[model samples]
Target: MPEYRAPLADFEFLLHDWLNVSEHYAQIGKDDIDADLVNEIITQGARFAESEVAPINQIGDQQGCTLKDGKVTTAEGFPQAYQSYIENGWNAMLGSEEYGGQELPYSVAIPVHEMLVSANVSWRLVCGLTESAVLALEKHGSDELKETYLPNLISGEWTGTMNLTEPQAGSDLSLLTSKAEANDDGSYKISGTKIFISGGDHEWTDNIIHLVLARLPDAPAGVKGISLFLVPKMLPDANGEFTIENDLSVGSIEHKMGLHGCPTCVMNFDGAKGWLIGAPHSGLACMFTMMNDARFQVGLQGTGIAEASYQGALTYAKERLQSRAPQGVQQPDEKADAIIHLPDVRRMLLTQKALTEGSRALGLLYAKQVDIVRFGTEEEQAKAESIVAYLTPITKSFFTDMGQEVSQHGVQIFGGHGYIQEWGMEQLIRDSRITQLYEGTNGIQALDLISRKLVRDGGRMLQNTAALFSDMINAIQNEADKNMALEIQQQWLAGSESLMSGDAFDTASRAYDYMQFCAYSLLAICWLSMKDRAAQTGNDQLASSKAKTCDFYIKRLYPRALMHKAALGDSGEDLAALSLEDF
Candidate 1:
């Protein structure tokens, strides 16, 4: 299949007519970023993603990566396409203007990422890791590290990866045994073997930078004693340019069920030259610098997948001829008009549209918050950070699970075409599954929702957002509306206390209802927010799409919030009662 034609009209509605992207731009001192620039970028990024990247997706998967000797070579066409993407500055869109980055609003950057990922997500993993590496380094690394690393990384000339997982330590970082020995030169020799390292070894860039988490020689046991290190594939000298190969090599890459385009390497480090990124024994917090971004990007991964799947399903429903109308002849022409003419198929397609579009709106909405938190003045910064902190994990976990469910539904809508590899429907399913697993699994995400996010700070965060949801819920629904969104807000608000407790894990699940409630709530608010502006500006089509999607989200898709409410309450002594013997 060709790359998706991004629903640009729908997206435009989400950003300008629905979401307050421009308002946030003004808040961040980028009031100059009008709708025109944003639209152009969306157009260009979509063209580049659909044309330059989409073709190579199946090629990358079919050819995978070749590891002969020590070098990791990507599938054919990858290097060339990567160069084109770099030459076009696709890699530097959201980079700091202090460096060479365009410093475009994150509002614009996220949608660009969604375009690229929706086109070819697995092939784009290296860029996500690169973005994450820049985030971690910019926030915590020394000035020397920042000056040397940020420019190249922001430009994508040098790629980056986070090395944290050991064979014995996947979710549990406490067991990692990587060692960083002091060299008396403000450096260390890091020796560790990290598994499941995406972009761990690649020839697309001149050099590879790794932020490794390792323990010191005299460090205490477990995660607290661990520290973050900046380890490069090649050692840099006086000029901050690589001069010699570092003592790290790729051991192997995992053969996963999907995402074959990305090389998840088994990295073996034999005293790799390393520099500590943050304070000694503070690796976990340092890794969080990247983890949060990585998690949100993973959420977008789900959004992109869901969007792609929805597009595929919508296209299939419109074209594939199937049974006659159920309500006695809605399609009287030829053998059949299309499955889309059927109400049931329309139901599935609408559900996908409602959730996928809602998810996209949430991601962009958060990106705007990122701008405010990073660049806003004192008063707004506090509020923006609070909102970002509040929404980050929900975006990650919710969107990922959405990708899995929506993609599976896409497969189902295709029936047999979904099952076969030729149609590429199965590929979507295979590709989206990893979103839940990578960047912390959905299980880890739910725990985070229960722990740091929902409950911490004495439940103040959850309580604060209740007002935002309530305001959106109060929006009037006309006779034309069919979605049940207000009911969702009622359910989520009612269950806020339970969600704040450890019992929250029992409250929600892998189904993403609670998460979706939050995600779609943001969507509804963003759309409604934009609608207020659109009505004044006289853009009816854009405003109408917003209204329809919002209504569709509430009545058609928001009911999942009901299921999540039940899911949360279901976590009880019964779940804990089952033991190994019972199983």
Candidate 2:
């Protein structure tokens, strides 16, 4: 099996040097979480992930999940491993302390999450979805709901799943046909089938809390009529004892291309007892609260997978002997030098490293903004929200795309061995393929970027974002670092200018390309920030490596934004002109 190790140094660099997470937390009134504690959490989290979680990745993938008699059983060792996870208090690490949680900031939780994702994406899904569900319930659920549900969910005795898509409803929730009828006792009966429900049901926990979306009898025609409900596998009675089973069952587990360890269930909620979460006919809004959180983590999945793939491939490259260096024989005593001597191999490795590291830097900073959005003063919260709104889709789409690319490069680096299963390289590719498809596809993410975030506000958010980047650029005094920062600023300005002047349709047509351009340029800015910090540290090797990577990103990757820019300039006539008859 390919070994997985948490990139602790990268996380530390991001948390300590680049972002100054401790000071930022202080600014947001999170005084209790200092840097020392943060580092301890990270250290212990890595040890747990490396020793406990990663060893099961390949085993889980090979064994997969099994279902029989309306019950789902996770692969061998998962339940035990999960018990260890819960017992370690990792599940409640980010939840609120009022309900028996650690109440760690999302910024701290995110690094630990990155480690979990890298060690085992499949197992990570269980806790990741639960945390998101907890966020939604905390944000929108009524007091009664919180009192009853939040304790168990927060304590990790029960897990949670977000049920958004059904057989008829995929991306468009308006087409949902799930029915919810009011009861005399003030509860409701939900009857419908929800597909693609991750961790929908499992024997690892006693109860599974499903945040379901269904329409009321008196509801309107479309999405506006929908409402959110808390439906659990085990319904609590009047005495709040969950001894009774709700009328919900797993129809079957999905035979998927990847993430087989996570049961993608078809949930049949037939007259299931449930209670309303948010206000009636506002289900979509409440679900978005959870989805937005999931989307950020899904984006980080890309970086996590990429990080794992890089580690595996780098190890193999340094050990696998092949042709000698192009310059001269570096290992004359050996039959052949290590594959790391090859230029193209280094290119692939560097590409993977740059994108993975850049994604980490950018993603952690985004999580800090999430912290501000949640805990900052009023003014800071408002500005952080706007920036986060613009960044969400980019992180969701671009990072996952990078994950896919990096996984493929891993396979290429290993050549024939990568295609083999025992090496565990292929598993990374298979696991990463789903990151692009789920939590809303990359295509849908692009539309959100174009229609909702960028164009909806008449490019105001984009401009504000650009101004923030401009401030970073203007702060640079070092000539070379300043040049790199200006390059990113100029590229961003050009892209934003195109988006601002273009019509909605034109912008929408090129949204995918625009997202790539915007993400790449933004990552360049992140690289520049790291570059400046590395230079100040005066560590020769660290500063030199950071400088080289920054130069490589600015020269090799940043130029790709021009391709997106050129593509965005077109009228999109060819696509529009091609009619159904033409095909």
Q: Pick the candidate with the highest lDDT.
A: 2
Candidate with maximal TM-score: 2
Q: Could you estimate the TM-score for every candidate?
A: 0.92, 0.98
How high is the CA lDDT of each candidate model? 0.79, 0.89
**Model 2: per-residue Cα lDDT over 142-240, one tens digit each:** 898998889889888999999989887998889999999999999999999999999998998999999999999999998899999999999777897
Candidate 1 residue lDDT tens string, 68-111: 89888888788888889888999998788887888787788888
For model 2, the stretches where C-alpha displacement exceeds 4 angstroms are 501-504
Clashes of 1: 8
- Candidate 2's C-alpha lDDT? 0.89
Candidate 2: Cα lDDT at 368 = 86
